[model samples]
Target: MEVSVNQDNFSILECFSSPTRIRIIELLNERPMNIRSLSEALDIKPPIVTRHIQMLEQAGIVASELIAGKRGQQKLCSLKLEQMVLNFRSQIHNKKPSVQKYDVMIPVGMYADYEVKPSCGLASEHSMLGMCDDPRYFADPVHRDARVVWFSSGFIEYRIPNYMLYNEQASSLEVSLEICSETPCSSSHLQPSDIVFSFNGIDVAVWTFPGKIGKGTAIFTPQWWHKDIQHGVMKHIRVNEQGTFIDGVLVSNMTIDALSLCADEEIVMRISSRSDAKRCGGVTLFGSGFGNYNQDIHCTITCK
Candidate 1:
């Protein structure tokens, strides 16, 4: 998560003020635990543990779900963020605004190229595109209509149209879409997927999604679609003069100028989870009909 020292973010900032809350975060980092477990570990009462978790949850620092326990339901809590990037950017208010921009709306399935493994599939709002886990189905003529696509391991590439003129100097590129980690067991807390983003084959940034947000399903998901993995967080990735940023966090030195946007007639955007990545959980892309945000891959380009 990216944050600044502002009044709106004070709730998140306050999470560090209490030693008990800090300890709760540290324990959740190790693994998801119940209130009873945390109370026993910290030598505190169950009600007190709940109060601390409530504070963390309010700040978007932690999440929990109710499940059956020995006597009654239990709240299984987990860390909502893998990490946070803090920016002391008082200078941001002094900078000039953007000049001009253009947008490209590309469907999730309109991939120019792909190399996918099993535990992969694509589907439209009305029906499944082809058999699940089969790579050949990805080439079906109807694949272009897919609204949601997922894979256990491999990369999918989309060629985003470059609308900037030849003489225009591209300033930044931003891509936003809904996505989440795909796990076989439908486990959201423990399984993390390291998703890598690339523009023109140059890896721009990588983010480790902290699994599915919760047991809740995406608001826009079709009723026919049934999967253990339900919802996803909307992610915004921007590449500008300074560097590549994910959710406003600088993740790399790859700047917009490095991409030579005008030289390439089209930008090849790729999303992948390499088997070698530290967190090898798969990836799922939500489109107009399938995820929290009812939209396809949205790419915007600003020019100087």
Candidate 2:
């Protein structure tokens, strides 16, 4: 589930190295079970099962919760992931690039400015931030931990450091995020929306995303996240001397120079669904640890 396992993390590696733990994962994949059930199924002692479960939980491979049972409350264990990806890039040597670069990942809920309408709300992996269609919740302190946000109209803005662009001939500025078209909370059918993106108030590009994105489970989506909408596709938007592009295809003539980025200046990224657009189905932004792409607002500047 977009797991980035660094080779240096011996503790996590050791957790997976155990055959008993591996068997535990396989058992949980079938279905969530309690300590007693797991012990019986795996023929392990209760204490050993508890110990392995604790280790798996610490390694983020499993999650447990207490639930009402006939005997009282029982701890239920489940697999937290369907797959794991090992990243070995840091272990390999590569040639350095010629350009200087800087990057930052801003969380989805950390909006510098926002104006949203009803049908707007946020949620964490475990629970909804507040009541759906309640605007006041958007301003709640808990929003800082939101993993996803959606609105029928208006904009959400983020300010990123632009010092890397100051006085330097920037080769390219890239902004990448996971997004999808929004719909009525109860609707499961497809809707279309024209989502606009801007940098420093300069319109960059408008992308049309087809709705009904949650047809299947997202690789990283938590089991508890049962909603009509669940995930979004990763989209890459770039601005350079040539033009603005969405996923590598030029979509507009708006160049990076038009943004007038300066040293120590903060680049404002605004995402909105204008009222005059052909479609205003809505827009949803997925944050780190929530969507198929385990990333937030990724911004990078390459300077020559």
Candidate 3:
């Protein structure tokens, strides 16, 4: 597909300009509402709502569906933020972020740990034993890598190189990865996770997954996945120095923290899934299905 916004051109800038359109996005973010609902929510007439909806829809910012309402068919409206880039300044381009490195000599797997539940059950290429058998296995205090299916309510700790301590101009550190969980399957109900990244056991940031991540993968099929419910239900969380991004859009400003690591201590990112079966059906970790940080679900640290 067409990836990366070329420049801060008209088509891109227009995506965020209109006041009515912005209100429409804000209203839809809460829950999908039809014409009457949106009209009441935004204090606009039905004709005005329809006009703005059409404009937003044309820009691919909003979409509508005809669903059964209390009376007749209702055009349920919602936002479709598949992915977008907002450039407040023209200095940056709609391309991948730049990466630079300071020379260092260290072991490859020096600061990484992974665990899976049910012994080697998650090692299978295609199975669900690790995630479905028991929800507690996710917090089993051991096991890491998985293949078919796995769940964990604990953090996957990765100690980053303590290069930031000595580096004079290390502006920021960026950690990006593809992650999804079983707890909250659908993006529609996308809720934040309790996953925390810690520096020397000090909590740095609490992260959550974005909506509609693994939409086409079979891994999203729950034990009781029904045709009535949306299949390929999944969510993703990708954060960097700029902001926290879910799916492909920016959601929050809780970016990765730059820490001093010259003491030779490990910088860790721990992902914890709260034990809420009602929220996440439990936590199913999708390793390879997501991008896995543009490489493996591993850690990367660069210091200037």
Question: What's the lDDT for candidate 2?
Answer: 0.80
Task: Give per-residue CA lDDT, model 1, range 159-267, as digits (tens).
Answer: 9988887778898899988788774233445368899999998999999998646346555578887676665777889999999988778999999988878844999
Candidate 1 residue pairs in backbone clash: none
**Deviation from native of the Cα of residue 68 in model 1, angstroms:** 34
lDDT of each: 0.82, 0.80, 0.47
For model 3 the local lDDT of residue 9 reads 50
Runs of candidate 1 with Cα error greater than 4 angstroms are: 1-98, 183-190
Tens digits of per-residue lDDT, candidate 2, 1-304, equal: 2244665566677888889999999888655688999999989899999999999998788888876678998988876553455665543457544577888888998887888887788888788889889888888888888888888888888898776744577777888887987743645654789999998888889899976565566655677876766677778888988999887688999998888777778889999987678998778888876766666888888787
Badly placed stretches (over 4 Å) of model 2 are: 1-98, 183-186
The lDDT ranking, best first, is 1, 2, 3
Pairs in steric clash, model 2: none
| Candidate 3: Cα lDDT at 35 | 93
Model 2: how far residue 262 lies from native, Å: 0.6
Better of 2 and 3 by TM-score: 2
TM-score of each: 0.67, 0.67, 0.41
The list of candidate 3 runs beyond 4 A from truth reads: 1-99, 102-121, 126-145, 161-165, 183-263, 276-281, 289-295
